[model samples]
Target: MHGPLNPESPVAAKVFPSPNHGERKEGRRPDMVILHYTGMASESEALQWLCNPVSQVSAHYFVFEDGRVLQLVPEARRAWHAGRSWWNGEDDTNSASIGIEIANAGHPGGLPPFPDAQIESVIALTKDIATRWRVPAERVLAHSDVAPGRKVDPGEKFPWEVLHEAGVGHWVKPASIQDGRFFSRGDRGMPVEALQAMFAMYGYGIKISGVFDEDTEKVVAAFQRHFRPERIDGVADASTIITLRDLIAKRPAPTAS
Candidate 1:
């Protein structure tokens, strides 16, 4: 927490230390990588806010619009980015994952396309972190994946397929959107329970209740935002269900520790 900052990944050009980090709980080593968008008007403002102690939020690394990467918090430390998040049975996501904030004028700024250079840098940085830390492809997740109703960053515009092609994250071609038996808010039955079970099986933090409630809607939307992004209205259409099933079926096996 002192002295000259040392960049943990070679992808990072320099260190821009932020005071908004703490020790990882129980000395947990990062086994996941969480991607996010700054959702600000400018990259400078986003970077400044992250480094400012008052913001109380930070990521281990920050990527600029033109593809420049900066180390903010040491990889060994816990950055305060994943607030009130849960993933794959872990509530302390900050302690178990490395956070990367991409500088994009996210949803608020019309969900601008990420430059090819910037996305290439993201792929390189993610590959480095996943390789060095032994992070799994499925564990490389969007911010929306962890905090369902609360957060949505590195939004639908993010080229998850590109990252998968670059061997950074898990992905499967989304099933074609179509009409059929779908679940939505207010629906309830054994089918709903089955749907909930499938989502929970895939690491979404949702109760296995037999009713399609608000929380279920939110989780469905979150799943779509990450997987079947073509339509994200919180409705579980055949396309969404098929896509989720395919992802689960094709998920990479856990690597031996």
Candidate 2:
């Protein structure tokens, strides 16, 4: 509820402070950046919803379709976004990350394209935040990445590769989709356990129970949505697994504290 705030990053045009944030728990410093899409048809309404106290949701920044950037919450504070989300064993993502909500129609509006100007602005803003916070490349994540089944904003149509090309986030060429051995729901075995283990090792919240259950499927789909976005059927095909291995191999070294 702070009156007219100053923008923290040079990329933001102005401050549009929201009342929906709090101090980061345990005095946590952000090491991650979570991207989301405001899935409403009207950008103004979406922004208002985030600022409304009744909604209990807000992000650190808001990016409009024309690429205008607005700082809704201060970077040091914890925005109310990323509810019930987890990443790399951290359940309180709101405290551990900065959230950016991009204005887009998302799946509900047939997945509209993000304008080039918008994408460029997102790149600049993300790079600024990541640089200031020393956020790892892989830690620049989608809302769906951390909350899988519960959310899917900033959908596949969002150009992650574009951001990666600008040195903002992680990206590798996805493997070609082809027919091969695949694992699906209800499958069980050591291979399934191994698959789950790999996902968990890569920071997905999956259980290695030697069975491909519903949760595993959701995680797989989430992985596909972020990594191998060419197809997101929740089936772990050869392309999906190989792409994951490539990503793991190319993941940047952990940043020193």
Candidates in order have lDDT scores of: 0.94, 0.94
Residue pairs clashing, model 2: none
lDDT of 1 by residue, 107-178 (tens): 999999999999999999999999999999999999999999899988999999999998989999999987
lDDT of 2 at 216: 96
lDDT of 1: 0.94
Worst 10 residues of 2 by lDDT: 1-10
Residue-wise C-alpha lDDT for candidate 2, range 106-157, written one tens digit per residue: 9999999999999999999999999989999999999999999899878988
What value does the lDDT take at residue 29 in candidate 2?
98
Q: Report the C-alpha displacement of residue 211, candidate 2, in angstroms.
A: 0.7
* TM-score of each model, in listed order: 0.98, 0.98
